[model samples]
Target: MNTKSLTLRWNKRHWVLLTSLLLVLCLVMPQWASAHAYVVKASPEENELLVTAPQRLTLEFNESLQTAFYNIKITDPDGNQADDGNVQIDPQRPHILETGLRSGLGDGTYTVSWKAVSADGHPISGAYVFHIGEPSGSPAGLKDLASGSGAAGGPLKWIVSFTDWIQYLGLSVMLGILAFLLLRIAPASLQREPMDVPGSYKLLWISYGAASFAALVSLPLNTLYESGVDLNQFSWALIGSALKLTSFGQIWMLQMLIALLIAVTLLSGYDLDRTIRVRIWSSYGTLLLVLGWLLTHAMTGHPAAAEQRVLAVTMNFVHLVAAAFWIGALTAMAVCLPLLTNRLPAKVRGEIYWVTLRRFMAWGMGAVAVLVATGIYGSLVILPAPVLTSLFTTAYGLVLIGKIALLVVMLVFAGYHTKRAKAATGERLSRSLKAELAAGAIILALAAILTHLSPGQPASAGPYQGTETTEDGSVITLQVSPNVTGENQFEVSIKRADGSVVKDLEQVTLSLTHLDMDMGIYEITIPKNETGIYKADDYISMPGNWSIKVHALTRSLDALDAEFSIKAAKP
Candidate 1:
């Protein structure tokens, strides 16, 4: 082929490669980005030891946290209030909050209850038991805390972390590549003859389009994990519920816009009517993409949102758009720099790449600045002073630190890429830029892992401790002892039809069924102590007839359950 034909051919090849990458990225990013929010660590670590009573408790989340209608409750061993006051967002940490524990908790078992809206606006709540002093009576058995006994398993946690990492890395790669294509190749392609704008447009749209599909798949996976459903028998309702959440809804809407943009861009390639409308739609679609990013994460408390939702939402939009532009521009530079060198005259291509690199560097730097400023402001709005130390000590705090570290690495790569692009010696420059891009991808993957880990449980009394046992292979035995007042404790021993002690059984679970209240049934595991015996310690807060159901699983996995009556009288 002649020199002119050869140049055109190379351009076509570049376009094809760019389009393929976009398509792959879109298909993969959402799965990585849409990880479920979790608590990785908390203040007053599980089974913690405090030399003295703490003035306040803090809970940290892995990602930015939402503060609307957050609730936390602390009750002493005897069911007396331990919470000093209402729960409030702390002023120092972006993803955590602190609340006062009611004073004078007189050394006893305490139950901390918590409920909060995650960054995505999902409400999550649970309870943990902690003691101010030495625990009384025998502790509950480990079998009771195992899987099938209602306790989360280690494997499940690993799955959550793995999926989270996948989504994070995927999103970074997808965004980075798209940015590279738009800022670098698109402009050049437009300037060339017989502009393949339609093809380039398809690449861009498909990248986002694939992202939506990936998100859809991820939602179902998340639902299954959360519900602990068998993969083969996963319920569609769970998937439907996941889609209804704000994050999924925003992404779905963005996908629609992407679809429309692709249609308009393709039609614009032809001598189409309503050209103005097409342009308007295209611009609106871009704006929606920005909005999608903003709204998707807005449920997480924004620095301004703690004070007012309107301003927070607005700032969040700006932040997301800026990020997209920065990442997209960097990706474009990486892909185009080499191709441009091969296509245009050496000096002309070099100058073009340098000028583009300089502008993007400035823009990316500005984006980073805004991200940091807003991030700090947001943290202060939610986290209080007392629990600040939890940020580093807890799981959630560590993840946040990891994310910050990754951002720093990205900045370093950006700096190096800019410097080398400006001072490249032909072939060596292209390879170096590619390596930098690869490094950015790795950073994103780490972010994905961070998202999957739970931030930390709400600062509470700590973990429940007590013992349970079943006797004579037919009788169930339980003993209750608490450190706090106003909390009800129940101890019940039930005799089954068979004379054998229930202790010979393989597993034991206890449930409290209440009447006239929606307290919901609670299931607890009973552990075996010295000689063939099963024992448990559980709380029942009010004086009432509580049907205690003892379910014993034999070694054969056969379950035998017995019910007994119990009453709690005010002390």
Candidate 2:
């Protein structure tokens, strides 16, 4: 065949192989789905007008939330705080968050603002308006500062994500070293001894130090993300308040304690003597500390918020352990093997190399088995059937897909290394292990993003909609999504009676009312986008029929009105 013909054939073959791999991945990655927490319903619904003051304000979510991190504040129209300033999760319902109101709420408008970290460790929040007896002047709205969602923007977002990535990478390295020592090296050699590989123990110590520092630095970055505070404005006071008020702070506090414990234990050096009982005790204690460290992650993340929480948390813990064994073994071998081989006599070096590789390969195979099983289980618990089918449709799913792809590549390198390990002595084995570690680092990055990204768009009941013609022969259309009872987006489009799209308008205001239920008017200023569509987002809080009136102003006043309804229903 000619050169060009051969090149074309090769390209076609490459595409065919790539397509087959992706197809197999899709078939195997069915359960790698996840979701974010959102408000399902709230009492004293948004814009509700009450004859008697409410004794308490209650907010409910679709999934269980961390109580330690939730916040609710009520401010009366006069700008005075009306809540008791204490938020608690109801003992009867884990998903419900309640705060007591002051003894009496006089007439006027009151704003309820709330923030909570979802089961998946993502933060979400919103504000709603309610009236006592009669409506007063418009109250200022509270901004929702949920992390990794609508709350964070631009460089701030990248900062938070980067910090988290560092923490995760540090954790994987630390755990990997300890697990390698305790399971593979210590048990495999003579008398279940701690491997006396030079510089290996010191590498383990350094990994702990780096992980602890990353965890400490992450605490404040986490606070900034949760509180939506500007980087220039960060202060110790804000960090303190975060610890006092939110669940993220509390979980981070536990993580700090674990980090400090690990640090202290490492500082108190163990004897090099393998036969000493003290060495065994030190190893066991370090293992326990690392296990506790893993808890801080499991409790603060999606598994902790699962309905079958014990199962969820346990499965995730196992997944982390298995991952540590695989990644840590690769890391330990890569960093320590070269130094070890350089120091040993030629004959002993070759023997130790083959032995270590064989032992780690056997353990790694078991770790991979556990990882596959636990990963599937955790994904099923986090995502539903429909979401599973749309695994490639979301950012979270795509990241997950990337991780799986990298994992496949890592496995290929590992299998190649395993086959050559028995016969290959020095450079070739080292190169293969290094490639495996490189693949693992990419997988870690993808996993970090997956932890932060929302699994999919929150499932909604669909948009509440309305349309009306103005007195000036213009038409206005309004629509709201997942309009069931919580936060909803309001979108409006305008057109002339002549059937042409209305391109420009000075300002547009939307007011919604439910007079049958005595809910007072809640108004919002909708910004007109370049597309000439007006849009705004707010919480509806209650379930019932609603009346929407839109006012457009240019050189003249053009008014249009429509009706939409929201109902209480199952998701």
Mark the 10 consecutive residues where model 1 has the least summed lDDT. Answer: 142-151
Distance from true position, residue 566, model 1, in Å? 34
| Residue-wise C-alpha lDDT for candidate 1, range 1-571, written one tens digit per residue | 4323443354357545644554454334211112223344556543344556677877665455444435667766565678877688665675675688766567655566565545544344444455567643222331121111011323554554454344333334344444443334333532442222223344444554554455445555555544444668767665565556434444545645654553454345333354655544543444344345434444342222234556555554554455445555555566544554456576566566555565555446556656555444433333323236545543445656665676676677776765654463344345555665565555545444433443332222222233333443544555544412124344434445465443445656777654422344555666544344565544443322346676767666766655665433222
Model 2 off-target regions past 4 Å? 1-36, 46-57, 63-95, 98-112, 118-122, 129-164, 178-193, 227-257, 260-277, 344-352, 422-427, 456-571
Off by over 4 Å in 1: 1-190, 193-206, 226-233, 240-294, 298-319, 378-388, 420-428, 446-571
lDDT per model vs. reference: 0.48, 0.65
Error of 1 at 498 (Å): 56
Show the colliding residue pairs in model 2: 68-247, 69-246, 69-247
lDDT of 1 at 261: 56
Prediction RMSDs, each to the true structure: 17.1, 10.0
